[model samples]
Target: MNEQHPPGPAEAPGFWLDTPEHRQWLMSEAERQWTFFAASLRDGPGFFSLDTAGNPLSDDTQELHSTTRLIHAFALGQISGHAGADRIVEHGMAYLRDHHHDAEHGGYLWALRGDAIVDDRKLAYGHVFVLLAGASAKMAGHPDADALITDVSDILDKHYWEEDAGLFADEWNRDWTPFSTYRGMNANMHAVEALLTAYEATGQDVFLSRAGRILEFFTARIAPAENWRLPEHYSQDWEIDRSYAGNPMFRPAGTTPGHSFELGRLLLQFWDLSGRQDRNMPVTARHLIERALKDAWCAHGGLAYTLEFGGKVSASTRFWWPVTEAIGAVAALIKLDRQASDEQWYRKLWTFADTHFIDHIRGGWFPEIDNAGQVTSTIFKGKPDIYHSVQACLFPLTNGLSGHIDDLKHSEPVAMR
Candidate 1:
């Protein structure tokens, strides 16, 4: 008798619903999402986080709450032709000028109270978004773009850089002491991205150098150890942080495919910068992406949100942001290696569009999904977050519009020697 093999977990079905029909559906859906987002934008400083039922989440200092949402609104408004975007940016500019800037502390506060500062400490993620918001404001031709960038850059440079580690400090105390014990690949990755955007917007050599240094940081310190594909969290001295002091308690069961996929695209940028120096950059990127697709992705539908450092499998799925980044990364790869590209990558991207990120039933991309791929959970699902929308719109549009994958467009690389 012949032995039969079961479907290995590695070959498990993935959730992707991409098709020509789905593309049409996504475009239409994008339009609808834009309308919903535009309607949420406020003319004043305050904003609200709406639940699935469309009720405002809170009312206290709601205007100051507008900063996060405004970033997403500005990006979506541009893509969807929503008029509220103008007001959103306008309000954001005024808020940045009037409230966010901390002259005494030398960085923007995470939040502001009425004529007082709230959450005076700064988060790496929030500051990156502020940088992104500044870039978006510039794109929108807002007058405050220059000042916003300058102010945010001042904050970033003064407080975030860990000179010995040659990377960023994730969070700062009120006096701007780098206080976070655990440093994250995610935060550093986005800081590079934000700095790149700022460099693009301002053509400032300082920003470009900072971005390049971050790229080097990822290559040198962020990627995982042998047999590992995910990035490691570290301390200021670059020590692996198993203590969970500053890291999240719930580690994924395997390498995070979405993050790996995003890293692949980021590698392409670095590769482009290293052109003529090494042709293997793209090759290495291609292999990493293949690993992500093979081990980290699920076949039934939706990209897996988290992966264990040791490549162990997990049941978690249904985050929309990773899907968005996966799509953008693969799209970018397609543009870069069109000749050597496989059609399946494009199909994989489309598949995600159909299954996890798309709200085929109730509309808009659902925020959270459980392990079994069912959309039943809504306790933290489908909440309107400012960060997700901005990333969703910007990553897609950036890859969609460029159609080119060359990094020669970036500034000169920093000299690390």
Candidate 2:
């Protein structure tokens, strides 16, 4: 609106996926998403959760994941050469360093109320995003990135990484005491993403090796074993805990198709990062992705939230993230195979997202949609952050699994904004 050009769709008849103008449309979409959340800069250091209309919500407690994700998102903006993005990234870096980082405790807090600690538990789920944000910020040349990266990497290695299990432990108390023996696929999945990103930025093989160990446990072992409906909860020994249920919104009892989608994408990235040594990587990724696509996609429109252990729909409520991860997964497939079915599925998913979840008038996507195809926020309040939907638009624009947005300029310049 101000200095930026108005966002507009490409002049195309059919779906944008695999189309000649898709690159341009994707850039436009990225710009729209960035501009929408960039408005959060007005709220200052402790980034406030944004509503669908791009304003700060009434709830002012900023979660650590949200803070790190904003840093990651705005860093992507910086990498892509978005104007005024440095301000956003710098603001986030300052906030993360000042408020969220527990200087004495040696890990980030879970939730903060106006620079005060609310839930101070150090969680791998939140810490991985800290790693991700730091990695992305390092790529963007943020001044504070290296410190954050070193801090989180130390914490993860010392506290969370279990050598026997080859996966991260879920949670710990403030001073690194044992909170629980619980382990989860959700945090490990994101840890893979963060570790891979860290490897990409640092050129460190330890990060790559750690990520591979995790992929071996899940992708090589658990994925095909479970028929690609990846279980969410796990025992301390990394065995599937079929009876465990914690947070319905987070730690659900059944398998999450969204996670399969994420693992599919992350596994492919690991494979590519590993120099494509294992020929089975693509096959495993395809099966996991295709299995999720087949199992969770409703005949009505959007992807279901979670599935029962036997692959029936456990929770039919559609959330924005699964669709975002689905976009990433199918886009990853399109990079290697480019099947017509993948293309069609990609377009179909976008059509559903644009029709239901996207807020054209504002900028952010609605976080949830009910069974009747109406936008609802029963589980999540307002739009959480620009992380998932931003990736849905930006990640697809890159050529390979790495999705280095710094290289986005070399692609076709069709941002008809």
Candidate 3:
């Protein structure tokens, strides 16, 4: 949900106590889950969503967005030394080549059926993910990497960019005229991420320029005033429509927690790189994150998918990917030696896992957790959907594995040691 709601103190018994036995157990569980998810990648272009029976969600339409998510997972796999990142990307390249791509339109379609493009509408959300896949293929030194990237970049620059206002539109017609009213934080954030990676691949000034323009758009147009501290979601012209604010798809009441955490991390990175002063952006982003964290965490350790203003917070029982990004943002803040409360945020992760997503009773972590921290869904688990597992697993593990805790180890050895 909003990620602001800290789980109520009324958590399930024995959550996030950090006992050595529990730490070892959870670490092992994490590794096992990674292995299981990695092995699920099949002969074709996609990975299946696993359920309790170990059956892959075979329907092609189910996970059209896995392209980006898989790339993210592969990156995480690389970071964690899973040795399967290459295989995962290979499967993705095959899928893109075999099924998902629409050669005529110069972008990817959503579904595949034995070498034929199944759904050709071209989701803007999916396009951002394809950028990730294209880049991942490049990093893996796949044969089609350069060609894939150039094609995706052309589509993005041609269709997604708003040359008049210097920002990308969320969706478009065949000629790329803007169509969707749901201007989204998710879309823009992914675009920013994709463009940065694309720039890394090709070092094209044009790609970097687009990325910078997005940062500037957020800074000037979407950023809230000092007192309000909320992200603006709207057209490139910057209107305040309800459609852009409080989307209900991810969260029932539609509070934007992920965006807040993402913006905090992105702004921190931008500030470090540019040294340009924005007196209020950082403060506002931090406030949004803290607020989201407090609101999104459930009574137990599991997280609510999103926060809604009109009703009780809506949460899923299955765990989702934003949890890791949220944790990563907090860890980055901690690394920056900034004054943000890392312990509080970090505790939220452990607490949610312990109470909800960890599946201490079953095996492997659940893909989602409901309000009470019980497994609600397994829609995104299994195989190697890019962003889902890698972001979720690696972000928390890396913070631990990276020796970021060295300072605590030395100073607070009595407890942490």
Flag the better candidate by lDDT, 2 or 3: 2
Query: Which runs in model 3 stand beyond 4 Å of their true positions?
Result: 1-30, 113-118, 173-182, 200-202, 219-221, 226-236, 243-253, 273-284, 299-302, 308-319, 338-340, 359-364, 378-386, 396-417
Rank order (by TM-score, best first): 2, 1, 3
Ranking by lDDT: 2, 1, 3
Error of 2 at 310 (Å): 0.5
lDDT of 3 by residue, 78-178 (tens): 43445566687677677776567665656677665555556556556778777866765565466787887887777877777678767666766544444
Error of 1 at 134 (Å): 0.8
Best by lDDT: 2
lDDT of 1 by residue, 140-173 (tens): 5677788878877777777777766667778777
lDDT of 2 by residue, 1-417 (tens): 323322223355443554645666677777778888887775655876787777778888888888888889988887787877888888888888888888897888999888678999999999999999999999989878898899989999999999888889999999888899898999999999999999988888989999999889888898778877788888888888999988998898899999898889999988888898899899999999999999999989899988898899988999988998999899889888878788788877877887788877777789898889898888888778688888888878786887555556454433425
Which of 1 and 3 is ahead in TM-score?
1
Flag the better candidate by lDDT, 1 or 3: 1
Instruction: List TM-scores for all candidates, in order.
Output: 0.78, 0.94, 0.75
Whole-model alpha-carbon lDDT for candidate 2: 0.84
